[model samples]
Target chain A: MAERRRSEATRQAILDAALELAGEVGYAKLSVEGIAARAGAGKQTIYRWWPSKGAVLLDALLAYTTGPSGRIDDVELPDTGDLSADLKAVLRATVEELNDPRLSAPMRALSTEILADPVLAADYADRLETPVRELKLRRLRRAVDAGEVSADADLDVVVDLLWGPLRTRWLYREGPLTKRYTDRVVDTVLNGIRRW
Target chain B: MAERRRSEATRQAILDAALELAGEVGYAKLSVEGIAARAGAGKQTIYRWWPSKGAVLLDALLAYTTGPSGRIDDVELPDTGDLSADLKAVLRATVEELNDPRLSAPMRALSTEILADPVLAADYADRLETPVRELKLRRLRRAVDAGEVSADADLDVVVDLLWGPLRTRWLYREGPLTKRYTDRVVDTVLNGIRRW
Candidate 1:
């Protein structure tokens, strides 16, 4: 039990170091050697745990977002029972989070890392994205059961239609990330779901 | 006239060299010096012509997609008057383009480059994304005029609803980039536009 606890502390140190250096030098210049040095851990320690620097970066982001419990599935998507209001509130919060200056650099760096490596990207999707998406799907499914949304509506498509524009604007710099934008996305996609 | 012709040729050479080096070394290792060496132009010439390696990479992609005419606005979205069919066909073609193996490496590298630099991303939006979106918006407006789509639909939101999901799928590797996926996206967003 003590061994497991020590290992967990080391892992946290490595992830914290990875995030710090990735932000400082950006992902391209981020190195396993540098992360090891910063964490005061052996280089082989990181290699033993992660196949590449991008994988380490991914873990860092997952850890940061999930907090101490690392309970990623503990999503708190508001289900005020008014599906539209719930959606607007959640997406508005997302917009604010994305726009936060503190997160921007690390998020952009993480995106670059994800884009550069497919294996790491898959790990990201499985561990981080899938859990969050499932939680969201549950929320939408509840709405479907309530008859607020069409039974025939593809919940997957509905989720993407609402959130995908924000992804584009964030990654591609297509436009400003704003509450107004997310609100429009929610309303427009709700049109597809509620009626179609 | 002689100076202008030579300068244009030099610009093309630099861009060509940038693309080759970026493909070989990836954008992280791509450099003005390396591009200059390959193009047989001085580093000063490259620096004079482009702000950064990312800027040169952006230009190479634009030039490749736009052809030698450098006309970024020549979008050829099919308008067969069956708005749904037109959209499905075009989105299917897009899926094929994105799936092309020859384009994948460079496209990934370009995405990393864009994500790394905000100025470069803004340039990409102006030079590539905006023109294509305008062409798409025009097609949607045409449908609105034909009474096929609701006049009240925020066409920008409609456009994003269809295309943005694919962007998420592609960039995040969230799902298989398939004709089936694009078709579903097209139909789902069409439901919003046509009915709501």
Candidate 2:
């Protein structure tokens, strides 16, 4: 138990150091040596636990967001039975998370770097995107099952269409990602785009 | 006129060569020397005409998309004034342009690189994003003026909301950017998400 505690503490230190360094230097310049020195752990410790710097950072991000719970464990779409309210609640939390100063730069840089290197992108998708996507899809499917969604609706399109505006707002930084905007987005996707 | 023709030819050659090499080697590997060699022009010719590689590529992308009319001159967003149809039409063209083999890979690499590097990112916004965004805004404004859209609506939000899905689709290779998808987006934005 003592050895396990030491190992866990060392792991957290590495992740904290990596997150700080990734934010400071951007992911391209983040190095294992620098991370090790910053964390006060041996370089071999990091290598033993994580396969790559990307993995370390990914794990860090997961831990940072999830708190004591493992990634994807505690987070769930609001299930108040009203889809709009539920979606807005979830998206509002996301807006806060995206704008969180602790997370904003490193996450953006990591995502940006992944885009440049296609190989890392797959890992990024698996580690980050897929879980979130699956969670959202599951919630939307529940809505569909409950008849909150149109019977003929395509869940995949529903997913893209649901998140598309929010994605645009965050990625482009072109407009405010206010609750009002999320509300409108939720409203627009649920109803058809045609005029009554 | 003869001397002017010579200058124009040289400019065209430089741009053509830059685009070709950007595609061939990826943006990071492309250089002024490669562009000059491919264009059969002197290095001084490139240096005299353009300030940087980003500028050269931007001009090339503009020319490729808009021809000699310049980036904003063509104004393809039809004022035929049926806002939904007009929006759909322009988006359909954009989908084709984005999917075109000639434009996809290098453009992706450049966008990816800019995401990581702040300096390159500013250039990208200046050379590509600003002009395009301005044009889209104008098109939306014209629609508002013509009574096709809500006069009091937050036009900026609308523009971001409209393009957000399409951009995500293209950038992430999320799904087929077909006419159907484009039409659905146009419909979604014009109408609200709420069920009547």
Candidate 3:
């Protein structure tokens, strides 16, 4: 029990240090050596726990958003039985999270890092993208099962449809992702873009 | 006219070489030296023409896409008076261009470059994003004017919504973007995500 506790503590310390440094210097500058020194752990500790810096950073971010007790499993669109309301509530929360200065810098940096470095990119996709996408897909499937969405709706494209606009906005910093906008997206996507 | 012709030829050669090298070695490996060598032009010629690597690459890409037509000035979304077909036709053409092997690699590399490098990111936004956005916005406004879409619909976000899913699929290299998916996105954004 004591060894397990110590291991967990070391793991958290490494993640915390990685997140802080990734935020400060950007993901391009994030190094295992730096993270170890900051976390006061041996470099081997980070290597043992995570395969790469991106993996460490992904875990740190997942931990930051979902918290220790909270899992991605808990991060679902509420089935409050109204699809629109549920989607709006979730998206509004996402708007807040995406806009948060504290989170955005690190996340963007991490994204940039993965894009620039193929090794990090692969690790990020496996550790981060898969889980996030899976969770989102699961939530969307639930919406379909509840007969809230069009039976003919392709969930994969639908997921991209939901995420793509938000990504374009977030990536380019083009405009605001307002509650009004999220509501509009939910409305437009459900109804159809045509004037029928 | 002879001097003018020589200058134009040199510029096109440089751009062609840049595109070729960017595809072969990846964007990070591409440089003025490489492009000049590939084009059989002097390094000074490249410097005399463009300010930065990012600038040169994007110009090369723009030239490749637009061909000898110069800028797409007279280009307007076909207002065939049938809004859905017009939008889908434009979008399908865009989808084809995005998926084209010649364009996709450099475009992806450039996007990756922008994500990693802030300076390049701004350059990309200015060179590529702004014009494309304006073009799309004008097209959407035309649809509104023709009474195909509600005037009150948020045009900017609507445009993003329409293109965003395809982009997400494109960026992630997730799935094949077929006409079926394209039509679905159009229908979804036109209507709404809800089942009535």
Candidate 4:
């Protein structure tokens, strides 16, 4: 029992060190050696638990964004019976997360890395995108059941429309990602999806 | 006149060489020296025309995509009376451009570089994004004038919605960027924006 507790503590320390170092030097320059030194843990400890620096960074980002839950699967889309309000709430949270100074640099670094490297992109999609996509799909399904959405509406396309603009604005920095913008997006999409 | 023509020819050769090298070795590994060697031009010639390798790559990409016109400002959005059809046609063309083999690598490399480097990002926005965005906004304004779209609709949000899904799908590699998908996105947005 004591050994397990110590192991968990070491893991947390490694993740904390990764977040700190990533923020300080950016992810491209961050190394496992630096993380180990910062955490005061052995290099073997990091290697035994994670396959690469990318993996450690991924975990650290998830932990930082999602908190102690540390699992993206734990993120549930809000469904308050009002589909528009629910979507705006979720998107508002997303805008906040995207704009957070502490998280933006690492997220941008990870996004750039994934785009440049195909192997990492595939791994990231499987581990991170798949679950988050599934969760959003479930919420859309609930909207359909509640008769808020047309039965024939393509939920996949709808989901993409809802989330895509935010990603574009964030990645391209084309415009302000304000709540007014997000709310307008939700209103336009939800109005389109709802049965007249 | 003869000297001016020769200078123009040499500039075109440099851009072509930069494109070819960027495709062959990927953008991160591509160097100006390699480009100069491939083009049979002196490094000084390249530096005289463009300040950085990123500038060369950007010019090469724009030249390739925009064809003989060679100016992004020359590309205009279709303003056919049928907004939905016009939107779909433009998006389908965009899809083809995005999926082209010769263009994809350099484009991805440029995107990664822009996201990682703020100076490059600003330069890219100024050179590429500004003109394209302005063109799209013009089309939306025309739609408003024609009574095809609601006068009060947020044209900025609508433009983002129309273009964002395609970009997100392409950049994220989330799903197939099919013509069917593009048509659906246009239909949904047009429906939402149509004055009732």
Candidate 5:
């Protein structure tokens, strides 16, 4: 029991160190050695848990956003019965997250790292993307139950339509991710999905 | 006159070499020195013509897709009188471009490079994204003139809604870029934007 507790503590320290170093130097320049030094843990401890700097950073990001006790599966969309308001709020938060200076560098690095490696991309999809997508689907289903959307509506496509613009703006840096933009997106999409 | 022709020829050779090298070694590993060596041009020559490897690749890709005389502005969407058919045909071609092995790596690299650098991102938006966007907007305006779409429709938002899904899937590697998917996107978006 004591050994298990110590192991868990070490793991948390490593993740915290990784996040700190990632924010400091950015992901491309972040190294395991730097993380180990910051955490006051040995190199062996890091290697024994995570394979690479990217993997460590991914885990750190997940932990940071989801909280210590939370898993990626625990991510939830708002369900205030007003679909437009709920979606705008969620997307606004997303825009904030995307635009956050400390988070943006690591996020960009994460994307580049994922693009460069197939294994990392698959892992990210499985661990992060799938869970977030499922949560959004669940919220949309609730909206359907509330009569905010049609029961026959293709939720998957709707989800893509809702998410695609924000993702494009964030990834491509094509436009400002303002609250007004999110509101417009939600309004336009709801016009299509809402029952007449 | 001879000197100008020779300089243009050297520029073309460097671009070809850069494209060829980017494909062989992947973009992350590609270097100006390697490109200069392969093209049999001095590093100074490459520097005089293009700013970065990403810039060279971007130019090379434009040249590849548009042919020798074609500029980025020359890219046009189809106008088949039926909005659905025209959008799908253009999107299908886009899907093909995204899925092409020869183009995918360089494209991904270009995205990463653009995301990392504000200057490159602005340049990409100006040189590539703006033209494509303008062309699509022009097509939508034509649809409006034909009474297929409502005149009051927010063409810019409509454009984002149409392009977002494809951009998201290609950039994030979230799902397959299939013909059926493109058709579905067009159908759903048109339902929102078209005149009732």
Candidate 6:
């Protein structure tokens, strides 16, 4: 029990250091040595647990959003029972999260890294995207039960319509990702997602 | 005039070499030296013309997709007097483009490279995204004039609705990108983009 407790603590420290350093230097300049030094853990310790810098950053992202438990399902979406209001709030919060320098830097790094590595991409989908997507769908499912959304609405399209634009702006820097933007997005897509 | 012609030919050869090498080895392992060697040009020659491998690949992408002139506006979208048919056809063609191994490899490389470099991302937007997006919106605007779409519909949202989901599938590899898939996207979003 003591050994397990110490291991968990070490893991948390590494993830925490990763987030800190990634934010400071951005992902392109992020180094495993820097993470180890910040965490006060050995390089071997980090290597033993994670496969690559991207893997470490991916876990850090998971832990940052969902806590150290690192379960993607643990990430929450608010359901005040109004689908429109709930979606707008969630999207606005995401805009704010992306605006946060500390968080966005690491998130961007992880996203770029995953683009080059197919193995890491699969791990990201399985560990992060798949579960979080299901959870978002769960909230939408609740809305469907409440008769706010069309029962026949394709769940995948609903998810993409609401969230994909956010990703595009984030990745491409196409436009300002603002509350107004997300709000407009929600307002526009609401016509598409909800029962007509 | 002869000197100008020679420079243009050299530039075209370098861009062609970048695409060929990128298709073979992907962007991560691609090097400027290898490209110079393949193009039968000096390393200094490549550096004199293009800033980096990504820049070369970006121009190569522009040329391959839109021909040697590399005018994003010149990349055409069909009208055929039907928004639904035009969009479905375009998306399905995009699906085919993404599936093409020669094209997809370099496109993915450029995308991943842009993620890591802010300057490159900005150039990508200005040189490729902005022009192509405007061209796409031009096609949609014709729909508005024809009374096929509502005048009040937000143009940005309309662009994102059709294109953003495709980007999501492309980047995340979340699902199989297929004609059936693009057709459904057109069918579903048609409700939101067009009138009730």
Instruction: Please name the candidate that would achieve the greatest DockQ relative to the true structure.
Output: 3
lDDT tens per residue, model 5, A1-196? 9999998888899988887777788777899999999988999989988888888988988887899864977667877777778889998998898888678767777887887788888888888788888999999888777776777667788889888898787777778888888888877776632123
Ranking 4 against 6 by lDDT, winner = 6
Name the runs in model 6 displaced over 4 angstroms. Answer: A1-4, A193-196, B1-7, B193-196
Which tens-of-lDDT digit does each residue in A1-196 have in candidate 6?
9999999889999999999899999887888899999999999999999989899998889888887677766666898877789889899889999999899888887887777778999999999898989988998788777787777677777788889999888877788888988887877776643222
Q: What is the RMSD of candidate 4? A: 2.5
- A best-first ranking of the candidates according to their lDDT comes to 6, 4, 5, 1, 3, 2
TM-score of each: 0.81, 0.88, 0.92, 0.94, 0.89, 0.92
User: Can you write out model 1's per-residue Cα lDDT over B1-196, one digit (the tens) per residue?
Assistant: 9999999999999988877787688777888889999999999998887888888888887888779877767656788988889999988987887787556556767786677677877888788888988989998888888878877788888888888898778867778899987887777776642221
DockQ for model 4? 0.47
Candidate number of the best lDDT: 6
Q: Which ranges of candidate 1 are over 4 A from the true structure? A: A1-25, A28-53, A193-196, B1-25, B28-53, B193-196
lDDT of 2 by residue, B1-196 (tens): 9999998998899888887888888878988899999999999888887877877887787787778866565554676768888888888888887787578766775666556556766766776777787888888888767666666566655676677777887777656879888887777567644433
Name the lDDT value of residue A95 in candidate 4. 92
Could you tell me the lDDT of residue B17 within candidate 6? 91
**CAPRI quality level assigned to candidate 5 from its DockQ score:** acceptable
Error of 3 at A34 (Å): 1.2
TM-score order of candidates, best first? 4, 3, 6, 5, 2, 1
Residue A181 of model 2: what lDDT?
A: 80
| Residue pairs clashing, model 5 | none
- Supply candidate 1's per-residue lDDT for A44: 100
Error of 4 at A169 (Å): 1.3
Residue-wise lDDT of candidate 5 within B1-196, one digit each (tens)?
A: 9999998888889888887888788877999999999999999988887888888988887788788864967667789898889999988988998898678767777777787778878878888788878999999999888888877677788789888888888887888989888888887777642123
Instruction: State candidate 5's TM-score.
Output: 0.89
Candidate 4 colliding pairs = none
Best by TM-score: 4
Scored by lDDT, model 2 comes in at: 0.75
